[model samples]
Target chain A: MKVVTKDKGVYSFSPAHKPVEYVKPGELIILETEDAVGGQIKSEDTPLESIDWSRVNKATGPIYVEGAEKGDTLVVDILDIEVADRGVILVVPGAGILGDSKFEPRVKIAEIRDGLVLFDGLRLPMRPMIGTIGVAPEKGEIPTATPHRHGGNMDCVEVMRSARLYLPVFVDGALFAAGDLHAIQEDGELCVASIEVEGRILLRFSLIKHKAPEWPIVELDDHYSILTADEDLDKAVKLASEQAVKALMRAKGWPFEKAYMFGSIGVKLAINQGVDPKKGARAIIPKTLVTLNDLLIESD
Target chain B: MKVVTKDKGVYSFSPAHKPVEYVKPGELIILETEDAVGGQIKSEDTPLESIDWSRVNKATGPIYVEGAEKGDTLVVDILDIEVADRGVILVVPGAGILGDSKFEPRVKIAEIRDGLVLFDGLRLPMRPMIGTIGVAPEKGEIPTATPHRHGGNMDCVEVMRSARLYLPVFVDGALFAAGDLHAIQEDGELCVASIEVEGRILLRFSLIKHKAPEWPIVELDDHYSILTADEDLDKAVKLASEQAVKALMRAKGWPFEKAYMFGSIGVKLAINQGVDPKKGARAIIPKTLVTLNDLLIESD
Candidate 1:
């Protein structure tokens, strides 16, 4: 099938967006997406407020894949990210985790020069990835600021190119929307900004028919990440551990007690987003240390 | 000149408790301190309402160091840790970040088996370090649970052997107190309970005259860590960045604005402790990444 071009603003997921009508396990779909700001902020733009907020973080089309059911998992294979011309921007404003008083008005722009993100006389190797990508939430329209079960605004740097993000399907057609492309960002993006740039995001999606998790479970090549949020870091970790245990139970058919015990023995926790002061804390638990072979579950 | 051994009775750091005489920097001091529970709960002790709340987290003596005055930095180098032949126990009750509802009565004992901390069938490589060690607050005596500028209960895992922690001297003689040794603990010790053990803590202190931070700073072989505690992670990172900027400014002689801009260009922020639940959020900026050469400060 021919890939969709940019002129077609409204791309249908069934035939136009997805490369193939039916996606097999480990299948790939390289869907290209626009930048988070949607060309609102340009290099010549002086004041940041000149950019409209309503159009910011406008995601790509809802990439619908065949055989992606509610209980299935959509493995988004982020193959490659290419910056055509303009680079990303890092802005600190009143809306983010850092309130107005702490941050002064400053805009840091990046230029993809010689395959590197050049910012303020420093060259940062670009590792581009989608900042916000998720299926529709159950209740109200979730903003791009918060990360939910749908896997929006995860901002985890490890989910860069070549990483596989396993998102649980919610609504029919999965209604996957992805954008907010970043050139490079630290784990928490504590500044509430990154080298946000206009780039083309290419990702392939595959369908895995498994029981849906209560939340999103991301699996990179060597690591398994469980997204969890809580009022505090301690509670966030506990909630993450609980989610890990639940994932373990689902994957291994072990009892809750056994999963809990096993987690205490082997599970290691990592903080994903600690700088977002208001919404409590967010973290991810990688399953690299915990082997499926060690569990009671049989591999496919 | 001579190191003092354990004194009889519970060693307390209160004003009423006897002060341990000072030694020069780089001199080893062996201290014997009660567990965080302060002997209220023993090996076989069960959770009960009779526990003394004030006695909990009672620190050892305020080992007054010789030549340690205000404006000097106390470099506490952890030398060694040796748990008693018996063991230690961990209990989850009113302690930790979890509320009373999630509280459960459970105990796990630790034993040194095969050079590893053994609890039931689990064998964890021992990484022993004092949990609470700091100078008396400038204003008055502060509880060990609340970590402050004095470095009480930082619960930083990096404070292990070979890692030198620089504490700011507030009062004369730098009244140093140390206790709450844990055999092994994850970053946050989320349960608020690590393998709490009664172990002999051996530490050497070195005085860096005329060099003290507003808050404590930790230095390992490869990285420098700034300690800051705030309700929000973003604020904590900002505090850490501010400290790093100041350090860079002092080291390079750059203006504050230049230092801040330089930091944005170079430094990498890491989430130090997102598990503390209460004080879990910490950010570490790598000194190597910052352009120290641009700053006009001299390096020692």
Candidate 2:
């Protein structure tokens, strides 16, 4: 068991980034995270425009998992999330889809209590989710705000409690970082922001040697999803669909055409988020249609 | 009650297309439908390349609803669907996301019996849906293959039994056409086709005078969705999001920003289909999130 608290988080996910903690597989670790803005906006009086943009989206740690080699799959199962008393939401002009339009930046403080996030007398059920979680890439550095094969700020809401996220290891001792917690967010996060909160996350890690996928895969209670993020949503969706088709092919021992046909009528494509930096599309294949045993690895 | 049987279906949706039968509002109608390929591909011997593309996607009727004038909303409530004994699925080499990649054109006939579509020794529960359904446009013709404001070929799987579809009326008599039945389809319909089948459909129509949305809206058992179709999936998603925001604004009597914020975390965005002449996106707003009274129409 390890409890790692890195106050100074990294602004990017890179192989060059130093690991804050080292732990073996089959271990439980606790991570304390800062908000997406790196704790810049404190209260209602905090001016949104005054925050430094370059210092935002700081991820907690590149926790090195021992014995995790390149091409391995890092299974990070979410155990629990404990949110702070307050969360921040900002409407920054020129940052999201509403960018181009001019308006005074607005900041609001949400109180997290009684299993709800209360803002301006409106109550929203608390569904805490990690907005950024990834492993170090093999090549150039990718900003924590961008999402790619290495899985940066995907902002997918489905990566929540009890979900198992599988990340492909690109370097030896897979450098994993997780932060940017949100109390609640819809599928699109269309406002370019969610109810950002600081929280402590509990995760259990396991390594599947040589079983890594090209992108991230999330196994939820009801379905398994292949998450793909690209600036162009069409391309993202295509990639996700291809990944699902590939999974079907590998699992069912079917040819490409047969797999493609099955995917067309069996896979469900969901939009994780469709605005700015990266547009995410998740191809969700229901477990009822394809059991986990069917998706078992042939070798690895 | 009115029974309209138009064997000669139309390939396009047009304001000029004559109505096969005219009926008063609140009347029930029974219409028989052809498949997406217009029932041309019969068996294994059917040549995939020789089928006429011009005659594809044949919708049974532009059955007119009397007193359904422009600016009114045509409410088509799907009551029932009776699928045929057999259905067809095709993997045309040049069609869908598989385009540019070469593969032998494959066709499979699925047996619809005992409430399942049996194909390749696999049984899929029959979830018959109307793939193409729309009202006439205001001006030019819209092909039944394309989904637009007039709601042509949406190809959404949610438009199934017990759902209510709202289409904006643009002509004196709302000319509603529906066909392209599918025995079952996943969300994306990635292979460009589903279990295409000929079927009989029962619909009940009602006119909401001077209260219509610019785009198509579907009221499912649990949620309301605003459907948008564009070649670019991103733009389509944006449009759908905006529509959901608009609904929230109109329904909750909130300002634009408040509605947008509510929509960001409360609504769900789904990809109806991402590969084709039209990339479909649906912003699904759960009924639990917004009450019907909040979505009250301000005007047509």
Candidate 3:
């Protein structure tokens, strides 16, 4: 397997960026990712004022996939995410929901050991996840902090180990990058930060020609989910739910109303990152209610 | 044990409503609740246009608590919820996120059997929950379809068996009423409906003088959650997160900023009912992170 280290990371998603490495479709890769703050906070005593905001969310690649082209789907099967020994979570003055007026800056460093992230006396289960992953967009450069169709900083907890993330390929080579690993995070991530951490991610990549999804799609053990991002959380939710309903309509040949109703009865709308510049929402449809064979396009 | 049936159901929450029954603190009661539409749709073939909009959401009581008074908390420990044999889910025009623009009025009937909801060959696990539960408000009457400080149609799935719901007592007697049972529902209930069913609810009541929450709270096996409802989903999320932070600050004697940061790392904000007129959002904090003894005010 090929290995991509954090030293080769980029801070933005752009089609103009050259690939750091090239690998064939269906190849496995091990990616070493930096924390969301890009290793700036080294200890609990590190001052939040000393950190550079411009250097945050550095993604680990634009790993070129051989034979991948525009209008195709880039399938990244997440096998494992091993948390680093130490991590830092910082709540700065101007960031997150409470913002500057209500909250002063603070930092907490956590240690990963014995299947838990230790924060003083509190021990939370270690659930490592990739916070940002995306392919190159169509034209302009998008900073790594924003999430859109090119899937950046989604911050969804379900984007954990064993989930398969499917990204739409807008540019040739399907330039895929990922980083900002977290030890654990609750849904909504209301204050805009989780247990920010560093980690090693293992993934297998494949291409589905001419079958691109409008937004990122994640296939979990028992469900299929579509993620959408927008400034308005309600709009994000509506967009994601619409995608789910479209998939159901295509698969079951049901009317839009029936598909929408089925979504109401079975699909779960989850908040991914509520405090981001582009907040994200997801519609998760249980696989038990609809089979994989039905959801995927037959022509592909 | 006393039993209250749907024959004593009311369409609004008001302190002036007479109590259909009375029970002392620590006494058990079994209540029979009608569906959200007041049992309007009987079968799959039932016309969506026939449902009377004015008669919807008939909650089954204003069951008076013998000793509950103003400025207190009415504790209702839910023991069990047995779903009825059949239920209806309707998505009508001019309702839900899709409303009249993208979706047409439609109805679905699901059968409850063998601990599953049978819907068109798909068997969904039976997760029975109370869609509405509340004490009468202090002021003017509020419809049964809206949820607020005096909890109404929260539509939260966690309010099921073995959960304890704490509602604020604004007036004397803590006139409690509950109905609108659901056999199964997703978190957001996006299309404005669920497996709307009737059910028998078993509960034990208690009163905590001068310790009422600003919103409804639920204590489950692994977590404690505060539910908030508003027309703006973002505002609702903010309100719920604030309540969670307040609880954390009161519990650990931490400053507001530290408590808010703790909430950002550990508390989960979940959408309860997005399609309702008053959108619902809940902040859930894991019990492992904070003990019950620390969260409750001992002075009460």
Ranking by lDDT: 3, 2, 1
If ranked by TM-score, best first, what sequence of candidates would result? 2, 3, 1
Model 1 regions more than 4 Å off: A1-26, A83-86, A95-97, A113-116, A230-238, A245-269, A274-300, B6-18, B38-55, B83-91, B100-103, B230-278, B290-300
Interface quality of candidate 2 as DockQ: 0.67
Model 3 spans with C-alpha error above 4 angstroms: A293-300, B293-300
lDDT, candidate 3, B23-52, per-residue tens:
998888999988888888887788877879
Clashing residue pairs found in predicted model 3: none
- Cα-based RMSD of candidate 2: 2.0
Better candidate by lDDT, 2 or 3: 3
User: Candidate 3: DockQ?
Assistant: 0.68
Kindly list the per-residue Cα lDDT of model 2 for residues B1-300, writing each as its tens digit: 777674857888888998889888888899899888888988967988779888789998888899998888889999999889999988887677655566778888888999998867678789999999998898889989999888988999989999999888889888889999999998888889899999899999998887787689889878988889999888888888778877877766767666666666788888887766888888899886666444435463
Candidate 1: clashing residue pairs, number: 16
TM-score of each: 0.82, 0.96, 0.95
In order of listing, the candidates' clash counts read 16, 1, 0
